[model samples]
Target: VSSIIVPITNVMNDQYCYQTSKKIRQVFDYKRRNGQYIGSNPPFGYVKDAKDRHHLVIDPDAAEIVRLIFSLLLKGTSKRGISFYLNEHGIPSPSVYKLEKGMTVSNKPDGNTLWSGRMIHTILTNPMYTGDLVQGRFRVKSYKVHQIETVPEEEWVRVADTHEAIIDKATFEKVQELLLRDTRTSPQGRTVHLFSGFLKCADCGRAVTRCSGKNNVYYACATYKSRSRNACTMHSISHARLEAAVLYAIRQQVHLAVSYSEVIAQINSAPIKKNQSFRLDDTIHAKERELAKVTRYKQSLYQDWKDGEITQQEYRDMKATYDRQINEVSDVLARLTAERAELANGVDKEHPALVAFKKYQNIDALSRELLIELVDHIKVYENGNISVKFKFADQLRRIAEYIDVNTAESPAWAV
Candidate 1:
């Protein structure tokens, strides 16, 4: 009776195993048909079958559409804007094209009929747009689940010029640059403003959003706009007013910057200690010595590990401690080097900030280009007191301090 029961259990096991194997094959077949196997892989045209993997060909029309999409995105059109542009013009999306031909497609979001930001961003970042075919960017964990992990970019299988590029290299690079620039902001915490992310609201710690009425541009508190009167009041300011204040402040700073150069020149021409050059060198050398000492200490911890004087865990912890000390020393050395270089280069005479500011020295008014170049941010406070911050203000302030310390007499040009 025991042997009969064992045979029955063995029969049950065999049936389960067969069913599991069959299901596994079905899943693999589904994946192969739907392109999920190469979903995260680089676009290398359509793959017809397993045997014909290398025989894939480029779809010229799809390549042309990709180029057009890249152009629209680079022109400051948002992803939604691009999708609308495409759909309104009766261009079929990738999903739509597949569906029309009765091809099975997966991974589409429910209830979405067309293109989306994720799709556009994917296309924008796709190296295929630049005529490079990428493959093996992700992988499934197991046969039971569809979860996938992304492969590192460096490890991705890349084939260059596998298809005609939709966008040129230079244009693609320009789009990338534009994308890298900080642009969008969520102010009011609900609606996004083009300029909302660009400006900061001083009172409520929210971004100021742009609003237009009767041909006038005004910025208001984003929190107040979304949450209501309970949150915050609308710290409203007109665009024209903001623009005027910013331009005026920039011009004033430029004037100050130009004057600073003259003051530095005056101070440099004055009689000072001729031996000060050696002092600067001594300061730099001392920093370098400190850096070397920390590096040597860090190396000794590794030596302890090699000599079997420390456990693996203890060695790791001690090495980390020494590494942190080394980093701190390195940071100090870098600062000292920069300061020494500044002193040697007659920093007051040839600072990049000073040079850039001097270019507009004779200009009467500020231009858009000038504003972007010099200004970091302009925060409008609750009390209507605007604090204008210039780029590299710390360096400028340092120069001012140096002038105060070194100059025997105050120059007329010193602001």
Candidate 2:
């Protein structure tokens, strides 16, 4: 009916088609603004709740599989290894599982129900696993055309705590780090060597390459590998020696972060705007509570109208009143929330940056996840000496010089 009407209205050169399209988009935007999941399908680990299809609930079986994939990846298992493990154990692939649940899925020729590295990779990297409802990732180019275009990431509609998380945010973030971090895979697509692109020759400033087998693993300068020792020395470092040193340095960095308060103390003679910040925080919470209450009341009014307890005109007027109040409260809430975030946006002992390192003190085994989190690079020298530069290494020096020396701190410092 929509297709027939649109083309027919266009023949008459009327505004009807355009107006109809605009109204449809308005409804979609309103639903999106209200945090509704407007997609036809929930993500792999989730299922649409029976009570409300727009709401998502954890599918325990699929969610368990998702968790297992993340766990294996964090433990330094390659995507290929994960795929093989799942397939070898006769575990159904995501597509197969989706088919079993009566959702649309496809299988390839020969009835082989094997999981591939690509499939495992997609699951590991999906942000939806972290309890965030991420939609609007793709959209039609226009109302007239059906071609789908990838929406800019910034434009994605995301809502947090929409459903139970299959994996923690930390784990999800770590997986993303691993994906984007400069790392190489072996013949079997496993990262046999932990420090791949991160290792460079000290003298030549070239990346070090991993050469040799299980009996002896070594990272030699890339220049030497390409042009032999004339261009650069081996800068040879055994995996064991490099791993042990780098691991120790990372733990020290975490320990250093613990005492960062001393540096902060020099900057702030008095405690942070304790009273003002505290009050602002309290006010933000109160406003949020008010917003929730108003939203619930507005929803109740809709039911009241449906039950004929209120006239349609009265319902409309009440809803408009509630919506106006919601908008005013939301504006205040956004401003205060932004101010609070600005005040609290640095690495403390409790910050995820430092907390990640603090969680692993002993460092019995080094994984790529921890390596990328802590170290920026490892430079190997010809004389078998190596140095590990950590991520945010510059931040420590800046923290020590907390007062910008030339400029006084902003009054918002106590924000």
lDDT of 1 by residue, 1-415 (tens): 9999999998899888778867875775554444333343224234334464533445566666777887676545666677767778887777765566454566443667677667777777766566555666676654446688897887666666654566777667656654554445333322223332346667777777777788787888778888776888787888777777776777788888888888888877878622124444567788778778877877787788889988889988877887887788788777766765665555547787788777876766544345445666567665555667787686787577566556545345543
In model 2, the Cα lDDT at residue 62 comes to 92
Error of 1 at 154 (Å): 8.1
Q: Measured by C-alpha RMSD in angstroms, how accurate is candidate 1?
A: 10.8
Estimate the lDDT of model 2.
Answer: 0.75
Per-candidate Cα lDDT values, in order, are: 0.65, 0.75
Which ten residues in a row are the worst by lDDT in model 1? 188-197
Over 193-248, each residue of candidate 2 has an lDDT whose tens digit, in order, gives 47766888899898888888769988888898898779888889888898888877
Give stretches of model 1 more than 4 Å off.
Answer: 1-60, 95-118, 131-134, 146-165, 168-196, 201-206, 211-216, 221-236, 243-287, 293-322, 328-415
lDDT, candidate 1, equals 0.65
Clash pairs of candidate 1?
42-134, 185-197, 188-222
Clash totals, every prediction: 3, 0
